[model samples]
Target: MELDGQRKSDNVEDVRGRSGSGFGQGNFGRRGIRFPSGGGGRGLSLSTIIILALIYFGLRAMGIDVAQLLDDGSSGSSSYQQQSNASGAEQEMKVFVQRVLASTEDVWTDIFEAHGGQYDMPKLSLYSGQYPSACGTASSATGPFYCPGDRKVYLDTAFFTELSRRFKASGDFAQAYVIAHEVGHHVQNLTGVLPKFNQMRQTMTPAQANKMSVRVELQADCFAGIWGRKADDKGLLSAGDLQEALNAAQQIGDDALQKRAQGYVVPESFNHGTSAQRMKWFKRGFDQARMEACDTFSDPV
Candidate 1:
């Protein structure tokens, strides 16, 4: 990833080291607690949730029904938003993220223009602890995600450390893959695929909906690979760069994350694909270097 002399994107809003807009002074706790405050609204109280989970289980042991208590409704919940600022080394990384985003803009714009479609550039919001997005309040723990409602990408730079230290998928390209995948979601949003998926999910069973999510996520991975191949063709990829991105796709596979977290893998609960599936789709996009090659929904994922 030789980013020297590359054009940096102007669409980035860096809010690394600053305080949040509504949330006042507070320290991050060891239990991974960081409040998400937005427009003076009450935050999602993790402490309260934990206490409720304990009481719910306690009642279940006492022969009381606790069906709703065990429900994982947190998936649909969004944290409140907070203001932020950036500085020093974070500032450098901010520039790097902008450059990578600019490269994606360049690659995708050319690809779209070649297909007789206009490419609408997306904004990248860099925050520290938490931030507000069209989808909801984004926390650093959510990693990097693109909000289709706002057509913007929310990234917490701390995830770069997770890539290198925890996920063992180290390298600038790995980080770039994360961003590109989120942009890939934006592509789906623009093409009406995302909304269609959302509508279809409403009528599908939980298992069926999870399968659709896997296909959607895998398609995004393939799109990231498409961008990687384009970067390689343009001489932007250095040795091992492709592997860096591929390793990231594999590392974040649903199977891999589930195994690490729970010591088991449940296919029906998988929202993202397995490592093999992820690797396969990414390779598909890299081999073809075209958006049409990433049609995971049309075929069996």
Candidate 2:
């Protein structure tokens, strides 16, 4: 990961040391709860959803407006404070994130142009604690996510520490892979894949919808690998960069995560793929470096 001279993306919104929107006003809501809509929301993060679902189940008996909490009425899109006093390693990571985002802009812009499409660079927001996004309130507990409703990627800088320390997938490239994967979801939104999936999921059984979700998330992993391929081609990646990202993909797989959290694997409950499946899809995109190779839906399940 050699990004010494790279240009930083101007699209980054650094809200690290600021108060959240008025939504942060003394509310009953806790920050970063992973609640998904019935038919049209990003799949919840594995561990977060399980924990939140347990709490949600207990609260449902009390007649809480779960729907309002899940959707949050879409505040549309907004950027909070721009000033960040982050210093030391955290500040370095921020600059690195900006550069990686700039790289994605360059790579996707070229790819989109070649395919006769215009690419709109997605906004990236750096936050600490909780921030109100178009999707809902983003908390540090929910990890990094892309909100298709806002066309923005939200990240808590603390997640980088957790990614390396808890997940044991440390490296600059691993962080880039995380950002690229979320941006991949933005690509899905741009190409209308997410809306179509959401529409179809309305008629699907829970298991069926979960399977579709695996495809969606796996495809995003592949898209991250596509960005890795571009970085490799441009001689930006060091020798260990690819393995860092691969290790990250394996670590965050739903199967691996569930096993770690609950000591068992439940395939039916998986929204993201298994460890091998995630690594395989990422490799597919890395090896082929094309969008066609990244199609998880049509591929044999």
Candidate 3:
């Protein structure tokens, strides 16, 4: 996790405390933020949009302000500041994020070129509280996610704090694993796997859809492993870094989360695979260090 000498990526958008209202979905199209173009995946429907609008606006009307919770104008305890840019430890964290993202760009771009295509790197949006997205409203509670709709990855860095406090997965490498996993989703979108999954999910039963979701998440875990392997090869990983990544993979597994939340596990509703499955797939990718070797769909978990 010694990213001191690493290059920083410029493909980051720092919207940490920029939201004024966090209302109206921020007029995406009007602001030159285009809808999801081409055949990557289906964007949210109009009815879904209406529902989101109602849910958001209704909360505002009832004085149940979720977005306002993010607006901490106080300087001392706040994680973000509207007027000032990132500073102090927050600034250091941003640098670390950029470095990790740059490493992914280096590794994935080379992999993509070897397979006969250019990697259109997905932008990383660092935001706090809430932000309008082409997919939907992204909140801190949603964790880190890749929005195929806008070809970007959204991260609430506060989640890193949560990762340490709640999940017991605390380390810079663990945080890198989370970022790489979401970037792995962007990989799926670019490689045509995501669109096919999206198309098929429409015709699938709830159980079937959940199964597909597990595969999707597991594959992303594998991709994260692939990045980890490359990073280790580049001498970027420390002695215990790999274990930290693996521990993180295990901690966020569907079964692990379900067990923690409800004191039991439900396999049928598991969309991100079990703890064992996540560890296994990640190791598979790390061992092989080959994209072809990470194919969890046809090969079985």
lDDT of 2 by residue, 1-301 (tens): 9999999999898887665665547643445654464434556557666887888887888898777676553443331122232356667878998999999999999989999999999999998888889998888999999998889999998998999999999999999999999999999999999999989999999999999999999999999889999989999999999999999999999989998899999989999899899899888889899999888999964
lDDT of each: 0.85, 0.88, 0.87
Q: Candidate 2: list runs displaced more than 4 Å.
A: 21-86
The local lDDT score (0 to 100) that residue 68 gets in candidate 3 is 62
TM-score each candidate.
0.77, 0.78, 0.80
The Cα error of candidate 1 at residue 222, in Å, is 0.8
Per-residue CA lDDT of candidate 3, range 1-301, in tens? 9788999999988887666254566533222234343334567777667887888888888898856654455445444553345466678888889999999999999999999999999999998888878888889989999989999999999999999999999999999999999999999999998999999999999999999999998999899999989999999999899999889888999889998999999899999999899998888888888999878899888
lDDT of 1: 0.85
| Model 1 misplaced regions, further than 4 Å | 18-86
Give the per-residue Cα lDDT of candidate 1 at 225.
88
The segments of candidate 3 whose C-alpha lies over 4 angstroms from its true place after superposition are: 20-86
* Candidates in descending lDDT order: 2, 3, 1
Task: Report residue 63 deviation for candidate 2 (angstroms).
Answer: 51
Which residue pairs overlap in candidate 2's backbone?
none
lDDT of candidate 1 over 1-301, digit per residue (tens): 9888899999898866554555433542233335465445675467667876798789989998766544444433341111122234676898899889999999889998999999999999898888767787888888899998889999999999988999899999989989999999988888889999989999999999999999999999899889888888878889998899889888888899998888999888999899889989988989999888899978777
